[model samples]
Structure formats: C-alpha cells, structure tokens
Target: MIEIAVSALLGAVLGTWPMYQHDPARTGRTSPSLVYTNQPNVVWKTYIPGSPSVPIAGADSSVYVVTQGGYLHKIHAQTGTLIWSFPIGGACWGIPALNPQEDTVYCTWAYDKKRWWQGHVYSVRSSSGSQNWEIILPGGGSWTGNHLAVDQTGVLYVVDCSNPDGMVNAINPDGTFKWSVPVPDVGGEEDLFALSVDEARAHLITGGWNSERRVICLSTSDGSHLWSVWTGSATGISACVDPSSGTVYHPGSDGILRAISSDGNPIWSANLSVVSTPALSRDGSMIYCPGSNAFYAVNSTDGSVAWSKPIGSSSSPAVDGNGNVIVPSSDGHLYLLSGSSGNTLWDVLVTANPLSHIACAGWEDRIWIFVTANDTVYGLSALPVEAKENLPEGFGVEFKSAGKSIYLFMPNDAQVSLAIYDAPGRLVQRLYDGVLSSGGHTFNPTLEAKGVYMAVLRYQGGMKSLKVIR
Candidate 1:
C-alpha cells in the first residue's frame, strides 16, 4: 500500500473558501504540499481598485471579492481576468462569506464612506455576481478583520454593532434570521472580532476591541449565552477556536494573546500582539501571529514565544500544510518564514501600500496564495520540495480545490473504487465503484462535515489517498 497526500496541509474545502479565514474555525491554515521559503513565483495578478477584500474562491478556482467601491467582482484566479461585477450598493471592507449551495456569497457594506454604520449584508451569485437578496443589519456596522463567517452547516454568523451594545446574529441558508444574541456591558465604542464557531460544541464566538473589550460566546443551536470574558483593555483583531477542545485563542485589543478554556476561563496569556489576527498551526500546538514589524510563533500551551521574524504588517498569517508561514506585509513585501525556527525563507515586494488581506486557491500541483495591496491582487505559488513523491505512474488526482472538484485518471481503464471518507475512516460518500477510464474524470462530491477527510482511490493492485480538508 502506498500513502499519498496533497499539498501536505488541509483545511478550506476542495477549493472554494467560503469563510473569512479558511472556514468557520477561522484557523488561517492552507494545504500546500510544497511552498518555497524563498520568494515564490507570481502566477498572476490583477488590479482591483478601491481596496478589495480578501478574495474567496468559487467553482474552478474562480475568485469572488467585494471592493470598497460597492461592487462584487468575479475573476478567474488562474488567469486573473475579470468575469463579471455586481453592484453591491456600497463600499465594503469585510470579507465575503460564501454559501455555495445557493451559489451565493455574503458581504456587509455601507453606501458611503461612513463605514458599516449604515451597513447592509447582501447575497450575490458567485457565478454571475447577481444580487440574490439583501438584509439590513440591525446595528450600524462591523469592521475589517473580524467580519461575518459561515460554518459548515451553511449558517452565516455576523456581528451587528449598535455599540456600546451589539448583537450576534445567526442567519439561515435562506437568509432568514435564526437567532440573535446580545453582547452586553459594552461600555462604548467597539470593534468586534470575526464570528467563528466551535462546530463540535455548537459554540459561536465574537468579541469587542474598544471600550467594550470582551470575548463573548453563544450557543449556535439556540443563541443561548455560553460565556463571556474580558478580552483586554487593549484593541485586537481576531480569535482562533479549536473545536475539538473548545479552546479559544484570542488576540485581544491590547495585542496580547490569551488562551481561554471551553468553560470560559482564561488558561494562559502570552505577550504576543498581532496587527490583524493569529493563525493556528494545523496541530493546534502553535499560533502564528503577525505583528507590526515582525511575526511570532507562540507555544499554544504555555504561552511561550517559539520564534519571531521581522515583518511589518497588520494582517493575518497563513500556514501552509508544510508548516511554512506566509506573511503579507504593509512593508510592501510578501515573506515566507519557517514556522519552526522563524528563519526567513524569502520575501518579495508586491505593493507599496499595506498588504492586509490574504487568501488561497489551488489547481492541481499549483496552490496560489493571494493578497490584496495597493488596489492590486497578487497570486503566488511555490516550487515543489524534493521530498514529495510523484503520483503513481499513469494514475493521479488533479485537485481543483477552488471548485470542490477532483479529477482522477489511470493509465488504463481498470477496475477502480473511489470514495470520500472522513478522518475517522467513516464513509461520507461512495463517489464511484467501477471501471474508470484512462482520461481524467471529474467527480463532484458535496462535503457536509468540516474536518479533515480523505478521497481514497483503490484498485485490485493497491490503494492511494489524498487529503481533502473542508
């Protein structure tokens, strides 16, 4: 039996990243079997004026993004060409959350420069950028780093701020209100964290950054109050939730990182401040934080700084499957740092303005990490490391992750069985069980669960598997 893995890291489904930072957990992790520490190759780029939010992928790795100019643009991630644009009705600074079922993407925006104070969240077709529906937010607005998020259940979580009080609203797939929980004791002005969930426990989390510095948790099932904690006196951006343990790693307003237990008690606090949010490694043992002039890797358990490398940016860090950190910096450079030693692998200037938004997509062997800076979107790809084994001769899987699709092929038309299984080895779906043709064949299997999975292909001779993280 031969073992196989794609891009090493897994998370974010087959490819269309519907969530803000790679899914409901907001883990900021990517599966790229190989990414160079040295400057990566810029596969493609396009100019999208008016400060585009980080791009989300649609079918076939096509890109969907909302611009501050009040337009939703769909561009091909591979060629960087414009597909279509839909009027969003206002300026947008928040990332768009995708509801793949309805072919819709959700975004919050204000008609003018007043920010989200006069905000509304609308759904647009990921295919044509056509408006599906709009919902006027109860409160004024929510800001950049901590925006709306969607869980695997297809429920959208958004923070509506009327500050010093705010409401966390959960919306159904049809855009109907499910439940809204209020975050009280918000003294005054507030910048809340992005909505994230510990899906296993049905917990939804958000927090305030300003005068109302608190991390609030609510039940996803009924909007019941779970727990709320004082985040800090300082301002912060986002929180990383570990669903398995129900732990939350919050970088509060003051920039210090704190670990809170599932029961709402603080476990440990670390001296880490991030410009945007923290990126947890796949194993949950380390957190990658991007600070104003450097990046830090902290031990998740004891709050110890494992390593720090210089990089100026106020954006979230992304960890590839290989455990390499990709940092898009305001210093006008995209840096690659070793997640372990914090050694500089490579850096390249992409924009003169702040590179604050980053996203990832894939097409076969090329996995592109994208970032927006100076009204431009840059797509980067790394070279394959020497250690990875090539696919079995005449048999392979072409992963079009951005589309949640896979292409499998064999040298000869042979009896092959391909199925999708969760990490626990339970069958999710039986994609095919017959003689497969030699040419690459496409299979579209909808993933319902949010966790690590494997798309295993077997024949009478042997078995091969590829990791599929949604």
Candidate 2:
C-alpha cells in the first residue's frame, strides 16, 4: 500500500500556470489531475514598476511578471519577494508564455517606430532572467492580451497585426520562423486577436475583429488553414480548448457561449450572457463564464444552465482543480465562487480603481490571483477552497507558513484568539489572543510535540478552526 499524504497527492503534478488563463488553450485552470489543499492566504502583495501583466507561474512555484515597461520580474510565489528583474525594452507588452520543456519564457514587446508599431519576442531563461534569444516580429505588429501562445513542442504562436494585415506567426525555439498565416478581416493597428493552440488535435484557433470569420482554425504543425467559422458576434472573443475532448468553448460579444469542435463544427450555443472566455472544469463537465453582473455555470454536456450567481462582471476567470472560480471583477474585487452552488465563498479587493486589466494563475495548493493596477502588481489568495469550504463571508481568514512560524491572517480588524490544541482536545499553546489587525501576524508559539493539532481562531464574526499536521 502506498501511504501518500494529501499534500503529496496534491502536488503529484507540477501546478504551473505558465501563461495567461493557465495555458495556451486558455483553460484558466491548473492541471486536471491536481487537487489543492493549502489554506489560501493573502500571501504577499508586492509592488512592481510599470504596467504589469498577469504573471506566469514557473514549475518551481516562482512567478514571472513582465510589465508594459518591458521589464521582467521573478517573484517568489510563497513570500511575494522580488527575486530578480530583467528589462527587455521600454515598450508596451502583453502576457508572457512559458515553454516548460526548455525552461524558457517567451514575451512580446512593441515600440512605435515612426508611427508604426514594431514588435519583438524575446526568449528569457526562467531561472536567472537572462536572454537566450530574440527575434523581430515580421511586418511589425503589436502583441497584447491573450495574443501569445506556446505549445508542448516549444512552438510559439502569436497574432501580429502589421499595419493592414493580421497574421499568426509560428516561431521556432531557436529564433527562427516555422510559418506565418494571414488572417483576413483581422488586420488592424491594434486589433484584439485571441490566439489559442490545441496541440493534441494539431489545431490553432484565432479570433478577433472579423465578422467574416469570427474564429479561424489552423494547423499547429505547419500553419495550415484548417477551417474557419463565423459566430454572430463581430467583436473579438477567445476560445477555451478542452484537453479531454478538443472541444472549443468560445464566449462571444453576442453574449453567447458556443462550443465548437476542433474540426470547425458548431456543437451547441448557450445564451448565458457570457462575454469572456469560459473556464472549463478539470473534468470537462462544466463551463464557468463571467457575464454582466452575474456568473454562469453551464452543464458541459447539453449546454444546460446549471447555476448562476450575481457576482458582477469580471475579467476572464481562472479556476482551480476543485472548480472554485477566481474572478477578478471590474469593480476591483477578486472573488472565488463555489463550483457547486455558484456562490461567493471568498473575495478580495485588489485595487480601488480598475483600469480593467486583471487575471489570475493557480499553482499547487496555493492559487495566485493578481491584478495590475496603477502600474503596480497585487497578488492575493483563496482560503482553502477544499479544506475550509464552510468559511463564512465577510470575515474571511487566511494563513501561511513561514520558515519556523505559521502566520495567521485576517481580512479585516477583529477581536481574535488563536490557539493550538492537541488531537485529544488539550490546549497546547495560545498563539495569539488580542485585537488582531488586518494583514498577517506571526504565530511562532511553542509547539513542542508534533502529530495532529488544531488551530482554533475565535473572532468577532465567528470562530474558524484549521487542522494542523506538524
């Protein structure tokens, strides 16, 4: 018999959200095999200069954040410490992608040269923030938002709108071109081109500003035009490719969530008021969508509406393996919705004023939800989505483990008492008992014996407890 701890089982697969919305397919969830158990805490909110993009989680749990100023920063995920920073170029940029096999990061930066935007993609070493190689984007285009993607084979797919045309360029790992396909009705100075690649089916999907073909499927191998489809929506949209079935779930501007096969066939369209990319479940059983003033969870099989909650509209949401939806709303609140009931289990205010650019990534038991506001990056957490599911609203409690101490966090000020009790209900030690202020507080109390203990926290709103296995 294999005696594996829950923590060990949770980390069976490396929990790395190395790109925006989790992966190149924009699924916005961690590995389908992972199950998170750590109590999500307000780990750390570090400030970085320039307009920061949503960070990518490296396989080692280190976060890589690139700013619009063309600077790359490596942050310690658990402590939110700035490990290193590398400047690419002082120009606007987009979310970066990670090539896991090569331990390399691919990011795009754009600069206006004589009123024309010239773009360059750089390959940086993930560990030391050193440049491996870089190549100028052909025809001079700007890459922004979710326009960048990388597959398992280290092939980079990016949308390049060079003046009068929008073309998807495939770049090899060695700073060479594989192929570039022209996407009609998508060429613009600043068009929103959503690029996603499904490696299993060898399909690459692109959508943006093209009423003629709202979605185009291409070959991931050699950039062949496989198929294209026109959804009713005219504006740009993104498609979430399901790894299990190669089903493409696209949320269009027409407020409909449509499921299309990789072969460019429409499976079904469900009107759920969704306008962002859908976050498919780990099991591919549900599609979570962020709509206007509400969040929708639809049954994946028949497009039946499972449940909906009025959580307000949000940036495209990211889900954990447990299906807990992490929504960074336009109102500057990052919410975690229950997978089953579509209810708000936890929420945090990332900023006061949202210029409307927010995204999140999940890694292991701890999920990293970040918002880039006012040229600064703010990263936050989820309170044990699986372990502490019954935590009430408003009075949320989060905790973290430092070197030799466990830090208890309070979302707001409250009269709190936290103590450690042995497995037999004997009081071991009192860590803290006072008016706890907002933010994290150290609890390095004398915990002599180690087996199973309970950290009970009593506060004004209510009492919450955590099981601690020392």
TM-score of candidate 2 versus the correct structure, residues matched by position = 0.72
lDDT of 2 by residue, 371-462 (tens): 66666666666543433345432245765455556667788888887776542233578888889889978777566543444555556654
lDDT of the candidates, in the order given: 0.67, 0.66
Which lDDT tens digits does candidate 1 get at residues 1-470?
A: 11223544332233335566776767777543324443567778898888888877743567777888988888887788989988877677778877644577888875445343555778777766777788876655433233677765668887665555666778887879888666665522355445667664333334444444567778888888877786544543557786556788877656678888888999998766666668877677888887776788989888888888767678887776567787888776888788888887877777677886677655543456677776777777653332134543223434333356776656667798777764322357889998877767878877865655567656544444566657
Candidate 1 lDDT at 86 equals 84
TM-score of each: 0.78, 0.72
Task: Please list the residue runs of candidate 1 whose C-alpha ends up more than 4 Å from where it truly belongs after superposition.
Answer: 1-16, 32-39, 100-102, 111-116, 139-146, 185-193, 200-210, 234-236, 382-470
- RMSD to truth, every model: 6.9, 12.2
lDDT of 2 at 292: 79
